[model samples]
Target: MIRTSAAALAFLVAALPATAGERMNLGIGTIFDNDAMGDGDDRWRSGSFAISHFRGPEWRGKLPEAPGSFIEWRFRSEIITPENVSGTAITSDRRYVGVLSAGLHTHFQRNGAEVSLGADIVAIGPQTGLDDFQDAVHDLIGTSEPRSAVNQIGNDIVPTVTLEVGRELALAGNGHVRFRPFVEAQAGIETLVRIGGDFTFGGTGMGAFRMRDVVTGQRIDGVIGTADTGLSFLVGGDIAYVADSFYLPSRLGFDLTETRNRLRAGLQYDGEIASVFYGVTWLGEEFEAQPESQVVGTIAINLNF
Candidate 1:
């Protein structure tokens, strides 16, 4: 589904005067999260993997307003299971759900604010093959089998649209500290409005375009940075009011928790040849019957050779 025709490729190459095929790759980022990395529990929000790519003609260390200055493609896979995957009987827990999403987003600047707009096709249920994937992984590790896959969420494909607007504030003159405040809106698989802000204490991603993860809300690099190498720390949080969710349908006797909250902190270490990022996030309850909140960890590594 993600194929580029020869004519289209030629058109894009010809459009960029100096960068025909020289500076195509902007950056790539991947995040893997599991409960084993945080809180020591693997109940709700079991695990997820996401990757994103930012590509364009060339990045000039600034967000351009041109229509196609930069393009972002993201893919994600996730699995949600009951509290006990091996249990034979259905407990009063969240139902099993598998999700795979792919989307394309465009980034630009408007009125001194960074603007991101995109749409995704979200597929949910056993069709995503996440149940089988998890089964294989657990079997290899001698973990309990997710028997509840037989009753996982029904199959459905939903189209979701997301939009975010944010502006960075330079708190220190030397670009050592910066703050970004943003507002976001989404409609589709989950309908909600969110407001949040992020703070940076170093120069890890000074001039790079970053993409926010859906589950953890961590900023992963999309466009590689060309700034100084060092260590940087980040802290951010957000609150949202959700109106609907396809994962936990009301028709299935699940009660939705309208207000959702998340808190996260991360650090980045940039070296001459590679960079590493690790972050932990506290995910608030999503349903009324949900137990206490849970913490999840995210990690990413990028190497330049």
Candidate 2:
């Protein structure tokens, strides 16, 4: 599957045309938390790199008067290494995520602002390395424990549909500085099947434990089943300084539920041919018991034809 996905991405990138007025962007960055510490469990070190392309109507006089539309596809991958693990032991995991979105954008001339409404389809796959953590827990805590059957704690493909609403405000100097803020909400069902050995412990000789969907309040049978729906919300803003031929973009944002806070600063040089951007990000992850953080730097090359 991984190979197939990689091949597909490569094919898509290669098939894209370099045409006038087309926009393409590629970025690579790491997320690190200076305070994240622990032997083997460096909670603060994880990152993802992505490439995106947007094609839309050109702007006139600082903002486009007519409404425009675009479709964007993003691919990202990240890895997380746990702390306090043993020698040559792999206690971390990796994730591959993809998002496809299409939206309509309108620039309000009177306000010097722009608004975008879009929908996104998201998919995530996790790759775990190491003994099933859930299995270890069951051996120690007993199968009857409420948490014993949560097998394969990390690996799964979660598909979701989300809605996004964002706006950009023009700041001082007509275009020298700008603030872009946006929010996204997502809700969908999560299906769990093919239980990992870690999720279940010895239980009344019943083989493995099972769980019902918390959202739909329905009993789930078979290895794979769908649960009730859940929602996630994100809010953030970017402050950018724009020049005739250069720009700088800074961002601060947070997400609810999962509790993610991020700060990013980067420099961008927009020339007649293409643009190059480099930046770093500080991200915090509020996981149970022990929260993790990371700091990462990124570089991106964009072509605006």
Candidate 3:
């Protein structure tokens, strides 16, 4: 996968046009989240690849071009390894998932300043290993019990809207630096199937294992019923150091989530034709019972036309 991305970057750089009007920066990057630490089990080895494209009007000789409009599209995927059965020490296999998204960005400027507003649509592809997990849970819970747990893992289509407001800071050098601190809230619904019909086993002597549908599959709904909402806040800055030949750029950002916090920093060498970046990510908090923190490495290449 890494090699293919590199080749694509080279093709894009070589194909860019010489005329200069509205310039666009297209990037391809990968992010790997290794074995989650807090979660004692090593069932999930997750990674994501993003193909991003951003474009805006030129500002060279123009009056710094107040603020133009831009758009971006991103596609990401994640995979999880199988988990160990509750009572049995046997570990389940692995699973894979893919998500695709496209967003629109609009930048508005007044007095030497810029603010951006963006929205996106996200779609989830088919997932694997969910049925096996459900079956395993059912076998553990037995049919004679009154309550059973159902695992609802399937494909979904979601539309999310985001609003971002940010400003640009003029640097002493020839180039300018832009800082954007934004808050994004996303909410959606999907269908879900419960394995074992809401039953607890072994510890509390609850009797009768019944697998009942809280929500029927016949209902015109996607698996894993919607109603899933996530809120994220990010503060970051992008610096562009313009030189006679090219621009040296860097970005640093921090993201806070309900389960984990992430710190990301990367540097990009932007030439007239293409750009490349190397980044490191540190994950804080234990997903399970482990003591050590998780770390991830990333690389990206961008081509402009």
Candidate 4:
């Protein structure tokens, strides 16, 4: 898998236009998510953090029409654990897993549609040090120790490619209400096909660049801009059909749910010198033996003081 992914990345890099690397500095965006902010139950899909830096020739207030006109370098880390941290027994829950990924992506427009293409080299298992990190956090917070840490998923590297295409439709001439429907496909790590749509009820992010969150699929800003100073609302949902997953090792008899669903809503405030985004997402069952659904919260703040 590692060799294949490397070759795939090489092919992709070779296919880029000559000017892909020549661009000016743009902006940066960051996001953090945790189950603690939701139901306070830190279990599967526990937490994640992501930061992306974008560069281009200039800020055109919208995606450029040419391919590779804008580039984004993204870094992300994630930790997933079983339901009970201290339990040593073999439950039907998912094994502890840690992931760190870095990738390069391009955002562009073609024929009135928005497109993103990227590839990530995803590292999984204890090598990410997430198990130890989680232990330290738990110890500091006086939470239960991760007794089952020794039984986590083995280490592996997977090369994943992701592609998404969508078009934004302005439901209101003033840009108060807009809807964007998209289709996304992935190859590697967890292979799946997804279809979804997002709605914006205000002018917070109009004509701005936004990046989608991996876990919750929430679109967060990718570049700080002269946003309209006001409050905006977001609502979105998606359904995915999974073909395979590395997290659910077939040899271990872990059952993978064929269908997955997610629903999310958020509010954003762009003040004079600061901006804040807060959202909650409801995640449907991922495994057949899983107990129930879970809710997670996400937040992103930028202060330009």
lDDT of each: 0.79, 0.29, 0.31, 0.84
TM-score of each: 0.89, 0.44, 0.45, 0.94
Worst 10 residues of 4 by lDDT: 8-17
* lDDT ranking, best first: 4, 1, 3, 2
List all candidate RMSDs to the true structure: 4.2, 20.2, 21.0, 2.0
| Winner by lDDT | 4
After superposition, which runs of candidate 3 have C-alpha atoms over 4 Å from their true positions? 1-45, 59-68, 80-97, 107-114, 125-152, 168-259, 286-293
Candidate 3, residues 165-230, lDDT tens digits: the string is: 333232323222322232222222211111111111111111100111011100000011111212
lDDT of 1 by residue, 87-181 (tens): 77465688899999877777879889999877777889988999899899989999988888888889888877788999989999477799999
lDDT for each residue of candidate 4 in 135-234, tens digit (9 for 90 to 100): 8988999988887778888999999999999998999958889999999999888999999999989987776777899999988777655657888899
Off by over 4 Å in 2: 1-45, 58-68, 84-155, 188-258
TM value for model 3: 0.45
Q: Which 10-residue span in candidate 2 carries the lowest summed lDDT?
A: 243-252
